[model samples]
Target: DAMVIQNPRYQVTQFGKPVTLSCSQTLNHNVMYWYQQKSSQAPKLLFHYYDKDFNNEADTPDNFQSRRPNTSFCFLDIRSPGLGDAAMYLCATSRDSRWQTYEQYFGPGTRLTVT
Candidate 1:
């Protein structure tokens, strides 16, 4: 089945250290999204890139960065992870972002740990 896959399903990083989480898809979708979901909170859209256009949510922190090198792969880089940054990082893809019913295919998220 076509799906999104995340690497290093569990990640451990020291405080203030940099960590990179990767996501790749087999669906050949045009849009990719990154979300952060903390304990007991709804997933918050961090950013997304459509083709080569990157769009970031207003409230997303500066430390969170994303790169979509190609149609099938995307990476989320945390420049400096703080203890509060510990959360599940999710990657999702959709065929197109302009559709009202843009249903996304999500990967099993990467859980980040900051010491």
Candidate 2:
């Protein structure tokens, strides 16, 4: 089974328009996280949910939101795709299977381009 998958490995959007990226996993972990990376730099945590406990990064914008309706699926919704929003959207998960350690495994990422 595919542990983690992201659709549309690349995405292009017009500035100020809404865009969305999807992520799914079979790892069956309780916690799911979203991150944004630019220019191949370190992934910046946007926000995450720990079985319903929502956590947002300090730098995350109001335009970005996430939804995890169930354990196997999650989504990132960017209400307004800005020119700066043109970056890589990464979906990652930590194996909450072991309460002792929580290490995040990242997907290949969805690259976003602004036109």
Candidate 3:
């Protein structure tokens, strides 16, 4: 069974403060995800990694950072979270990146609130 776990399902931080959100998977899927979803908009892929290879979206801002130390873990770090940075940070995993179509297992997400 594929399952994703995200710690601190709800997080609150002050403006310009730094925060880190973690995601871990038990199935050890090769592809780990770090994306942002604001309100009703679709989840935007900030960056992702399969093992050690990473791919960052061209439009992703520098303030958003991601790290994957091993196959099972990933982290999203916001250097200086602004008011607009408050959003639902979602973590997901898939088998691999080569497939044309694949299903992703998603964590419940960590909702970041900035005040």
Candidate 4:
């Protein structure tokens, strides 16, 4: 089945170390998004890519960054890991249309643990 895939379902990193989470999809969707979700809190939209265009949320911290080199793959880069940054990182893809509403499909997510 064509769907989103996230690597290294669980990751452990030392404080101040850099870590990268990856996501890919076979669905060939035009829009890809990254979200940070903490337990018992609402998921926060970090950024998204619509084709070659990149959009970042105004409140997203500078520590969070994303890269989409191609349509099928996206990367989330954390410049410095912190204990407070430990959370589930989700990757989602959507097909936007003027004719109909499209739903976003999310991957299982990558759980990050900062020591």
Candidate 3 lDDT over 5-112, as tens digits, reads 998899999999899999999987888889899999999999988778989999999999999988889999999999989999999998875656478889999999
TM-scores, in order shown? 0.95, 0.92, 0.93, 0.95
Residue pairs with clashing backbones, model 3: none
* Model 1: per-residue Cα lDDT over 5-107, one tens digit each: 9998999999999999999999999999999999999989999998889999999999999999899999999999999999999999998756454788899
Report lDDT per candidate: 0.94, 0.88, 0.91, 0.95
Per-residue lDDT value at 31 in model 2 = 84
**Descending-lDDT candidate ranking:** 4, 1, 3, 2
* 2 or 3, greater by lDDT: 3
Residues 39-88, candidate 4: write the lDDT tens digits. Answer: 99887899999897999999998999899999999999999988999999
Q: Kindly report which residue stretches of model 1 are placed more than 4 angstroms away from their true locations once superposed.
A: 97-100
Q: Give Cα distance to truth, residue 113, candidate 2, Å.
A: 0.7
lDDT minimum window of 10 residues, candidate 4: 95-104
Model 2 CA deviation exceeding 4 Å by range: 97-99
**TM-score of model 1 vs. true structure:** 0.95
Candidate 4: residue pairs that collide: none
lDDT of 4: 0.95
- Judged by lDDT against the true structure, how good is candidate 1? 0.94
